[model samples]
Target: MRVMVFVKATEDSEKGFAPTPETMAMMQAMGKYNDELRNAGILLTADGLKPSSEGKRIAFDGPGRRVIDGPFAETRELVAGFWLWEVKDMDEAVAWVKRCPNPMPGPSEIEIRPLYEMADWQE
Candidate 1:
């Protein structure tokens, strides 16, 4: 099964604050964790995102599209990064996430969601 792991953004991340020394150390730790995942052939790809201030959004209303600029008002709703992993099951993905280093200062969160299989569309 494939899963998408979301690294939730904090206020600091939305504000475009650079990682602190401690946060940097945590990132280094995460690097080692990523290496482990890579060696296990579970990590397909992963990347961190720039702050919303440098991002843009396209809104769709029927056939009309509107371009909206950031930084968006909701920091809590923004995603900071993501990881794509191919694992045996949700259980395996959860185990991997449990080993991740704290990616930010203060409270942080990560969400694991399963991806739909290609077969699901064949119905």
Candidate 2:
């Protein structure tokens, strides 16, 4: 199974704050964890995203489209980064996530959702 792991954004992330010593340490820990995932052949790809201030959004409604500037509100709903991973099952993915280092300076969240295969759409 393949899963996408979402790293939820925090206020600091949305503000594009500089990294602190603790954040540096956390990065190191995350590196080690990523190494483990790579060694296990589970990690496909991963990367952090720039703050929403540097992004753009497109809204669609009934064949109409509008471009919205970034610096969007609702930091709690923003995504800071993500990981694409292949695992045997959701349980395995959950286990791997449990071993990951904290990706933020304070409270944060990681959401794992399975990807839909083409077969899923077949009758």
Best by lDDT: 2
TM-score of 1: 0.93
**Could you give candidate 1's per-residue lDDT for residues 19-47 as a string of tens digits?**
67876887889899899999999999998
Candidate 1 stretches greater than 4 Å from native: 17-19
Superposed on all Cα atoms, the candidates' RMSDs to the truth, in angstroms, are 1.3, 1.1
| Residue 100 in candidate 2, Cα distance off native in Å | 0.7
In candidate 2, list every pair of residues with a backbone clash.
none
RMSD of 1: 1.3
TM-score of each: 0.93, 0.94
- The 10-residue segment with the lowest total lDDT in model 2: 15-24
